[model samples]
Each structure stands twice: as C-alpha cells, then as structure tokens.
Target: MRLSVAVCVPLALANWLLFSLSTMWADLEPRDLQFQSPLAWLALWANLLGIALLLAVLWRFGLEILEALAAAIKQLFAREVDWPAWFAELYAGLRPLPLFTLPAAALWGAWLVLFYFFDHPGGYATDVAFQIAAHALGACVYLPIFYRWRVLTKASSHDPQISG
Candidate 1:
C-alpha cells in the first residue's frame, strides 16, 4: 500500500504536469506547429501512460492505501485507537456520493469564479501555481469521501453477505 501510494502520487503529478503543458502548448502554438511537434506528442503519450498506471494502482491497491492513511492520521491525535469501533462509527449511515459531490461542486464553482476574476496572462510559474492550487482544491474535496468509500468497501468485502 505504501509502495502503491509512493508510485501513484508521482505518476499523478507527472500526469498533471504533462496535461498542463499540453494544454498550454495548445493555447500558445499554431495548429500546424502542434501537429508537427515531437514534444507535444511525447507529452500526450506520457500523460496517457501516467494516467493508465495511476488508475491501475488505484484500482488494485486503493483500499489498503486509504486504510493505511486513515490509520496514520488516527495515530497522530490519539495514543490508543480502537480500529474496528472507529471505522464502524466513521462509516455508519455514511452517504459518500453527496458528501463528495456537493463540496466538490461548491469548491469548483468558487475556483472558477476566482479564476474568472483574477486570471491573467502570466508565465510558467504562475500557470503551474494555478494548476497546483486547482489540484489541491480537488484533493480536499475528494479525499475524505474516498477514504470513507474505501473503508466501507473494505468492510463489505470482509462480510460476504453485506454489500456497500
């Protein structure tokens, strides 16, 4: 699980960088130039490969990764933790979709509004900063719901009769 996260995060960041570069190039380059550029093609393929790998890791080992993260976070604030009881209480009556979607929508809406009001033609650093900020915002919106869903899935998997 730790290995999966260590690999997945770097791949995710690389994908983001490639995606940002490709989009920025598209905006800045002529159509002919874009079509003829090897760097553009390389970036595209790299981004796709990174995405595929990241998704594969997440699909296979995501539950364990989230569980590990949850455990670590729990350890931070408490000396003694009851794993079963904590998870039971945490996931009790949980509805992940609304929890994820509502906050995500609100956050994205606010981000868009901020971009509209504050966007300017800046250099690479500024664009990268904006991209990082956007990804961080998305992470904030998705991580908790993802953790919840993963824990629920893990719990359900342990009991054959139960379904999530």
Candidate 2:
C-alpha cells in the first residue's frame, strides 16, 4: 500500500499536468503541416528524436525516485529500525512524492510545441518542432498512469498477507 501510494501520487499529478497542458493546446488553432518536401520530413524526424530524448530524461528521474524507495524497502526487509537519513527524511516528510514536476514538464513541452506550431490567421504554418511537441505532450500524459500502475504492482509484490 505504501509503495503504491508513493507511485500513484506522482502519476496522478503528472496526469493533472497533462490535462492542463492539453487544455491549453486544444485552445490553439491548427496550422499547416507541410509534408511537401524531403526537408520537411527530415525536420519532423529530428524533432521527434528530440522529444524521445526528453522522455528518456523523465524516465531517469522516475527511476531515481523508485531506487530511493527500493533502498528503504530493503532496509525494512532486513528489520532495520530506520531508513537512511536522507531517505528517512523523505519518508518522514513524505517528500518522496515528486508527482507534480514530471507531468508538468511534459505538459509544458507540449504547450511550447502548440504555442510555436500554430500561426496567425494569415501567417506561417506549423513547425516540425511544434508537431513533435504535440506528440511529446501525449507521451507526458501517460507518465502518470504508468507511475500509478507501477505503484499498484509494487504494492501487490510486497503484500504482507502473502508474505506471512
């Protein structure tokens, strides 16, 4: 249950952030997405790659939080009376939950795409970056759900009833 909550909180917050950003993106007008030339396709591919990199960074951050929790869990299993000081502080302060930042970043990334993609009534069309940003936006929204699922999975793994 504890592990589940730890995972779920971040996921929920990330989703909330996604929702917020999606809301803003929905407000913007869609501009031309020129797939006319090879250059355009190349640009699109580059942007998508960049978004993929951003996702990787987010993954690493999530891994850090989980690793911290796993260390605390190992101590629990060893019958240690207390967690390490830094993690103990986290547990005590319930600061292990970094639910908000991850998702918000995703949303902001999408917003940047949308903001940059859309053009004025008689202006330039969408950039590859904007399209990539929009795709990134979708990816970010899912992070929270993935985190929530991870929480549930870990909680089930450590079920005391089964252990006993």
Which candidate wins on TM-score? 1
Mind giving the per-residue lDDT tens digits that candidate 2 earns over 28-122? 55573234567755655665565556555545565576556556555554332223432433343334234443454555544444554443222
Name the regions of candidate 2 deviating beyond 4 angstroms.
1-33, 65-83, 90-164
Cα RMSD, each candidate: 10.2, 14.2
**Model 2 lDDT, full chain set:** 0.46
Report residue 97 deviation for candidate 1 (angstroms).
4.5
Count of clashes, each model: 0, 2
Clashing pairs in 2: 10-99, 11-144
Task: Report the C-alpha displacement of residue 122, candidate 1, in angstroms.
Answer: 12
Q: lDDT tens digits, residues 58-103, model 1? A: 7688666756776676566432435674455444523243344444
Candidate 2's TM-score? 0.29
Worst 10 residues of 1 by lDDT: 93-102
TM-score of each: 0.44, 0.29
